[model samples]
Target: MTAAQFKSNRFDLAVDTISRADLEEVIAWLRKYPRLTMGEESKRFEQAWSKWLGVKYSVMCNSGASANLLMYAALESAGRAGKRKVVVPATGWVTDIAPAIQFGWQPIMCESDPVTFGLNMDSLAKILKRDHPENVVLVHVLGVPVNMTRLLALQKQYGFNIIEDCCASHGSRHQGRLVGTFGLISVFSFYYGHHMSTVEGGMLCTNDEHIYHHLLMLRSHGWLKDLPAADARRIMKKYRVDPFHAPFTFTIPGFNLRPTEISARTGSIQLRKLDATIRRRVANHLIYQKRLNGAVDFARGIPGDVISSISFCAVAKSAAQRRKIIETLDKKRIDTRIFTAGNLGRHPFWADRFGVFSAPVADKLYRGGFFLPNNQSLQGTDIEYICGVVRKALE
Candidate 1:
């Protein structure tokens, strides 16, 4: 049901979780499919996502984290098997950096633009000129697509690979192109509270033939039997066959990261509703922009880029005030989340292990930022009520 149909008392945050429909799909798939989890549903999910994102190929893994690993593994599988350095923006989900660390690739950290909250172009240039990593993990922070036109131009000059991190971005576009398409390999998260979900899933997309096949092998046991690709013969020759075929073939070093059939079906159902979901989120965002003129402070720095409204993000003037806002909203049954990872590098996870440090732009975002209850099902009145609560909170 639409939020407008509910009673005014229901103004508080609707449950921050996936829909019943998603649950039902997963259940139904389990009942119908003999193998509760396998490769078929994953295969279908990949095809659907490719069509949705306008990419030629996709690889589905058990989780978004695994997808990132496969994206890098595919590169390593293609014989770039050295300490490949990857330049990445400092701000993003923790898992965004997981693959680089796991695969022995060095991560050259860059900063984010306070404005777009994507890559800070100036900092990126400095790193590109100095460190010159073989890759860049361009994160589309909070669904704001990076300045791809300029970044791609630089890519040509520098000749490094791009891995678009779409963990928080689903329907985002940059210069009329989908955010995930710019990178040599794009990665997405289907985690709960994202644009879509399969409980927990992720996808890797690309048009490259070798990378595509390598990813297929990398997701499973890195074996020929597990991955039934059209280019299996080519892989056999490339990996030197060990003279074994079909029934038993371990062509390359691989991992058993296959996703479940149930999860895949759930994701497929969710995928069907993606465009509509995106529209609802876009509409709700417009409502906030129009009505919440003076209710609360904004990040005020985004580069006027069209964001997918991954979250209804804002920056309250004071932490105490933000706390009060959350308290009030919670009393009203409303839910809220802190802004993106809250200065991610400051956490011990990065500092102790990677020797990473924080930056000025990220530190500020940490102290004042938060994301409100937002999703495709949210309606105009729901938005109005949310903004109303924010106005009340500010007062």
Candidate 2:
């Protein structure tokens, strides 16, 4: 008898696949810390993460949003919190802006070129006409660099700090530098569907000692009371105040955004396999671009930029065609979505905000924007099936 052909239904593909080693790591953590103490697991995870990013420090938290929040909060506590505006990608997730608001900083959202799926430096240039903010949050959407070179040049000219949001861009590299290392304080997400998974976690990194210490304190409660005396002195000198005394002295106003022991343990195991995962994902993108070339247009990196494809987003001939194509793909149980929230300018909370520019390009793409599954777990057959399904939908 002939063997039945392998097939996976929508139900089978509903969740992302977590490797056995990943699962084993979590189980082992639970065995070691039944109640999940925040200790060695967390410390080891931070160390592993710093080594992975090639940065001086890596701070762990419960989620990427938390990571963003902690980074901004650290900046705030270190004294750039108010009267400073932050330039952010006008095309990313909502949490990307939350940190700015939570820290009392004005968020100047910049439009992105939907074609390139990266930040539009022209918009940034226009806004920086007067004076640049001390903190410029440069979020790399869908694993693509946001004109980092130009942005960095502008930052150097105006003296603004760069904060790279690599939540969807864990392994992405730009000019031989990892995404996280490019910014003063960068963030990474290990959400289940990301390039790697620690179930749900985030990391914050920086080469700056002051930012690193502040991030550590803000990850927990506002109390720097438990920090080393010399660390407290360093912070005090930066802030020009005696905020803390000896033990139990409240240093900087902070919050407890700590990661659990399991998350840390899971992250460490996953880090070991990150390079392999990224290679597979990158290979899949090349094959995807090759197979779907004529049928689809793609985003090219800047003249000297290298991109990491977070999602396979594309422009459709028309909005209706896009919807129909999405429906057709849905019928085949192939999950897909828009590049990033359609466009940030259209959102009610942001649209009515003061000082926000009309994101014409990003808005146009939002109407026609769509994405397809680019998960590393997808096999050769899965890619072929996806391409086949897309062709049918287009037809």
Candidate 3:
């Protein structure tokens, strides 16, 4: 049975992740000082994020797309390990593929697992065996954690760099470790609809000291001033700059993608409630698993992985069937969407340039998969009713 409150309302795919109290807290702080640019609050948020993600450093930026760009730029600037080819999943956002091409790196797209919606290791292993790409960008699509233990083993055998894109995944884990900590560089998005929200912000995380410094420069305008004290001195000695000019030194090509004090303050407040948010999202997702497991093609978390469940994804048996299901959901006042940009390989941006390589699994998802509303604000009845609509549509 539908809840009385929800009977007359259209269920939305996302809600404002920011709480009213958190918004008030930021307003009160802003009124007191009026300084909203990147500052101590940004630093505080970065440190806290690092601690939570089990990484050494986290640099805040304007958006997750910028975080992706900064990561590729940093790797390119540092001179990648004699390997120019980067492998990315075909089922990721455009930013994931665009940055690699923009930075002059050759990116080969791989198929995604129908269940996890991450790079299929078998498919990736085949590409690694044939082409031997040095870098792999792994997106934990829709908050489902990839099996890192197996992926890391393949990394050891293949000797490649891993860039974990955890933009849709916060508080997600593979085994016991967090998703963002298992790679050379990790990225997160704190946009309005994600696990947490800073309104419009992202973070770049790394454990390596040099890469950390590189990210700092990339986030700002490639100035030595952004470097830590010792690192700044090292740069000064390397360049042999005048003491007065050292502070103004530009080390590498960079951009102005810094976050504001307002976003950082929001992030700080939102981070505290992330655990509770995940609990609600996961609980709602379990209803989908219990009710619609064999009836529809839904995203499934790998064994021993804790999913953040940003949304519930359903793949209809055919493209025509998907359209009918969406129509049914619409009539039921349920909202639905395509699965995360729907296979970047099939899109015009990639098709016009490289020509589309057949990624059967990703292509199938592109044609048939649609997203169901799953968020912190959804309750038991909402989840059940949404899934019920799907079951009836199939009937």
Backbone Cα, N, C clashes tallied per candidate: 4, 2, 0
Query: Clashing pairs in model 1?
Result: 13-334, 37-261, 115-301, 115-302
Candidate 3, 319-366: lDDT as tens digits? 999999999999977878998876888889898989986777898889
> In order, what lDDT does every prediction score?
0.75, 0.73, 0.87
Candidate 1 residue-wise lDDT, 143-193, digit = tens: 767888878888889878888888878887776777788888998888877
Between candidates 1 and 2, the one scoring higher on lDDT is 1
Candidate with the greatest lDDT versus the true structure: 3
Clashes of 2: 2
Ranking by lDDT: 3, 1, 2
Off by over 4 Å in 2: 1-8, 11-17, 225-229, 233-247, 303-305, 355-357
Estimated TM-score for each candidate: 0.89, 0.89, 0.97
Candidate 2 lDDT (Cα, 0 to 1): 0.73
**lDDT per residue as tens, model 2, 224-282:** 64355687777567666655443444576778788888777778788887887787666
- Candidate 1 vs 2: which has more TM-score: 2
